[model samples]
Target: MRTRAAFGRVGYMAGALALSLGLLGGCSAPSVSTQTGGPAVAPAQDRDALEAQIAEVTQALRALGPGVDPDEAARAARIAVLKPLDWAREWQVVDAPLVHNVKVVNGFREKGVCQDWADAMEIALHAEGFRTLDIHRAIANARNIKLEHATVIVTADGQPWDSGLILDPWRIGQGRLYTARVGEDDRYSWESREAVRAWTREWKARALAQQG
Candidate 1:
């Protein structure tokens, strides 16, 4: 497991969605802003730059093999999505979801959350024309409330049962993101919640420390 510090490298919260959206102007981290859910337009220059990066990553993915390599494509797609999101997060341009503690489903009127990460991933990947994976939102350890964790799931070639990957960038810090087979990685299990309580306790403690 990654150190708690790795998860809270950047601790400040974002402001209103409009203001936070403005942080996208230069792709720098700034305090995030929250508002009724809406898509914020990124600056043209930043968007263009991201587009170029996606194109580059796509080219590299192509070199993997003739047919679409779902794993490779998924990896590349995660990177493509994370790069910009990291920029936004680093600059505080991205809003994080509100968490009162590890147990409550606090209101989202404050900032971004798990849903934000998933939303950003889906939006950016689609914008990049990444078609290798279908995005799905899932809960880890559905049976346990305290350990229930939300994550973004990707199905290879839009097929959930065929091949799947988990694009969980929020698992670590220092602009880190995690990608793994849906049920293969020991990080979390899709079928049955495993170690979710421990993981949540660890992460929540780390988060609280950061806030302190």
Candidate 2:
């Protein structure tokens, strides 16, 4: 009794619903980081591994500068590594990032895309209000809509953006955090988020003028 278009809409909704239910049933919550003052939610083996990573990240942040506060470094490292994992679990990210992007686009998931990861990380770190550390937002492949990527960078306060450390969780997927110095990252040439936004605005204006 339904038209073909009506039947297609119904089928799409049903598919999305099924995917959401499957994700909920399959993904388990990740353990909270010890530095966050919460009991571990993971098994003993996984908990040990996560703790080791937190320590490593802490060391990396401290090495950024002699003036970097030890306490601030430890806190930043803990949030950088653990927050994304928590988000991944909540978003039920069971596939690679791009694959999960499809899920989000189709309404099978709420949020797990690269931009979402970057935005979440930046917000969490900024909340710490570190006096010895600075947070930056960056974009890669800004001219290519299909390949554009966003990430959060952390640097010693008063240091240049290029000298900072990159905190990216969406690259490897499943909430596995990746960190590297800005100069060491060979995959993408990063640009300041503000610069990219200004360029985008100018580009749109040019396009509109040409069409007029």
Query: How high a TM-score does candidate 2 get?
Result: 0.78
lDDT by residue for model 1 (1-212), tens? 75777555323232333333442222122222233222233456666765665555555444334555655574666464546355444434232322211111223233234445556666666665546545566655544433444566655454643145566544432223455566566645454223445566888899999999
Write down the lDDT of every candidate, Cα atoms only.
0.46, 0.78
State the lDDT of candidate 2 residue by residue for 173-209, as single tens digits: 7778889898898677799999999999999999999
lDDT, candidate 1, at 176:
35
Regions of model 2 farther than 4 Å from truth: 1-43
Considering only N, C-alpha and C atoms within 3 Å, which residue pairs clash in candidate 2?
A: none
Name the candidate that leads on lDDT.
Answer: 2
Name the best candidate (by TM-score): 2
